[model samples]
Target: MIQLWTPEITTLLTRFFKANHLPYGQDFPGHIPTGRFSNGKLNPDFVASFLGIKQTVPTSLDPNLSNDAFNGLVFASAGSGYDELTTILTGAIPVPKQLGQFKSYIAKLSRIFGNNEAQNIIEKSLAIISAGTNDFGFNYYLLPMRIQQFDINGFQDFLLKALHDFVKELYKRGCRKIVIAGLPPMGCVPILVRKDSSRPSIEHVWRTRMLMPVLQWKARFTETEEGCCGSGLLEASFLCNPETPVCETPSDFMFWDKLSSKRAAYKAMSHLLVNQILPKLTLE
Candidate 1:
């Protein structure tokens, strides 16, 4: 019943607040929030509202909450992922570390409520995860560590396996409802698009092609300008060009930045969460 990345819900939050603000941080005054990247609301805030729960307690906030107050919280960090490398790669908090924080959350909840109640809360609550683009960008493209250890396919498999294990740990600890996000077309981020504008304007090359989903969501953008084809190359070129002029309507595009996806990309993620992961939670 929890909705995380729905634009419809986000729009509502914007209207209700009567302020054009995103939950994520902005650099400009009155623009950037402390940590969030968006102008007003991030996916988690919107999702918490949609679930009718107050926004979940951030992991960092876990140390300060009363036990009773902790039971209803949802734990989600924007720039985190399953692999330690993703955060180290992105220079953001990694997934395993976040799980460590979750341990504290569980402990806090147990204190306010009895062990049974804490377990019950976690069992029913949903955990949503979205990460991995940074690993490719910050680690692979930027260095030789993971890339030296594994090829593109190998790296992809490694991260997914990491996810499998992370979710399994959550499940073992009482987290039953969980959602995992597949990679979107990251090649079109305004920054990467800009990067591609340099000397290497290659089509469907490993640099860009590797970023698209390997197995899931394969056919969706396969033919579009963002897909692995001649036109896709041209699109990346135009979009990446510093002189190409950035579009205000980022939702119309796929990639938001070199490391994140736009609204459309998140929309695809929402579908997988609802249609695929949600139904499977009870199966756990």
Candidate 2:
């Protein structure tokens, strides 16, 4: 299974008020390390549990963690993105580096399981990708401020190209089933709402401006932001301020935070996968 370029660990750690921010540390290994971007489990772990697979494999650091965990492996970093430039924010392992790690893992599997078994392993794998939010949230919206270079469309195009390339690489690596998630509404994230609000606006301009672009792009992907449990702009506000009153039901919302989705969002994503993408892939 693939769980690439997500901060599931980091978000959970921050939820407990930990300030150290372990997920972004560059020294953290990519494949089977114990120091996953958080204090506890990551989204992959939960996903593994749901699949009835062994808990997600670590980044290649923990000697105890084995390659046989999920009948494959996971090569995700807390804040990495599909693009190289986007990985700079958290100093996490970029997708290229993770691909290299996958190569090494494949080599070891080949040595132990023989060529046919290894090939079978590679062919039947499911790749789960959750990225792009960092590209907008940290790179375009936060850091140098991409609004200066291009409008939302240009930036979305750039991100989609990166994703396209990443998917192509996976196809080269013998993966046919690809599950890619679109960006959640990031504007209402507490980080953006609180930060952008400091700027001038008419009617929650900070939130509306930040979210609309992402929402537009959501329609481009098979799994849309609409009716997602935890990923909409409205939902993000509620999640970031759990104590505050904004939206009553989070199931229809899209964003879980600035960078992720609620359980419902994943369900929507999965529905698209099982119903739309999987059939096409099977035909391929």
Candidate 3:
């Protein structure tokens, strides 16, 4: 989520983190690094392929890249959240600004592909957003100011309002198909609460429906207690460096760094596409 001076990635950057983080794209073909948390393909890439739009999702900000925006593009920044302060802490692109970028993208497309075609693209395109976690992880939990300003419920409401506004903005820009991923069980995440483990924040009734992917993952991987990178507890971004010892069998681990695991992403997508989202969605 660090403000990048350039969208270009070098081989040296891939090996080291400044070449990009050591394992960000370590699982990709030929180990080519990308500016993402996952070691290989992300959830959007899987969604793109399933929808028959494309094979891989590309970042919209890459200066040297060429791709049809109609298929899909990523405006997501790591560590970014709906909360403005969360982005300020990590120098990430704020959700509001990401929406602004989407608007600008439509304008640019209008110039290149004509107004009707551009509008058609936006109306039909699926907009996927994953937020809320950083608001709690980067802002609320890390700083005392959040504690003073908002109670847990108040902060949750604040984030919900921010999310609501963001979706309305997306609707204004012609996005009829949108999927917003909610926060994970905050009480159990490695970065959030490091206690032995208890029931997570989600209520017992909805737990089965909401956490089916998590249940699926318990059997899918050998290691779920920690990440595949280094200590698997606190390391992320630059802290997860080349010197850090990565697990030999990353596929066996549920997490790659502090936040995500590539294999887990694949696992979740399978459940989502087959049982959760695909049948309900009309991508055509």
Candidate 3 residue lDDT tens string, 106-216: 898899899999888888777777778878877998878877999999999999999898889888878887776767665444443344345454543353345556557
lDDT computed for candidate 1: 0.49
User: Could you tell me how far off, in angstroms, the CA of residue 195 lies in candidate 3 after the best superposition?
Assistant: 5.3
Error of 2 at 154 (Å): 1.9
Model 3 residue-pair collision total: 4
Q: Point out the higher-scoring one by lDDT: 2 or 3.
A: 3
Alpha-carbon shift of residue 177 in model 2 (angstroms): 1.5
Where is model 2 poorest over a 10-residue stretch in terms of lDDT? 17-26
TM-scores for the candidates: 0.62, 0.61, 0.83
Full-model lDDT for every candidate: 0.49, 0.53, 0.65
Name model 2 segments beyond 4 Å from true: 2-5, 9-40, 70-72, 145-149, 196-284
List model 2 lDDT by residue over 35-108, tens digit each. 34322344555555455565454444334655464363567666677667766666666777877877777787
Q: Highest TM-score among the candidates is held by which one? A: 3
Error of 1 at 264 (Å): 9.7
Per-residue CA lDDT of candidate 1, range 22-81, in tens? 322232245543333332344555455444555432334334645434434434444445
User: In candidate 2, residue 193 scores what lDDT?
Assistant: 54
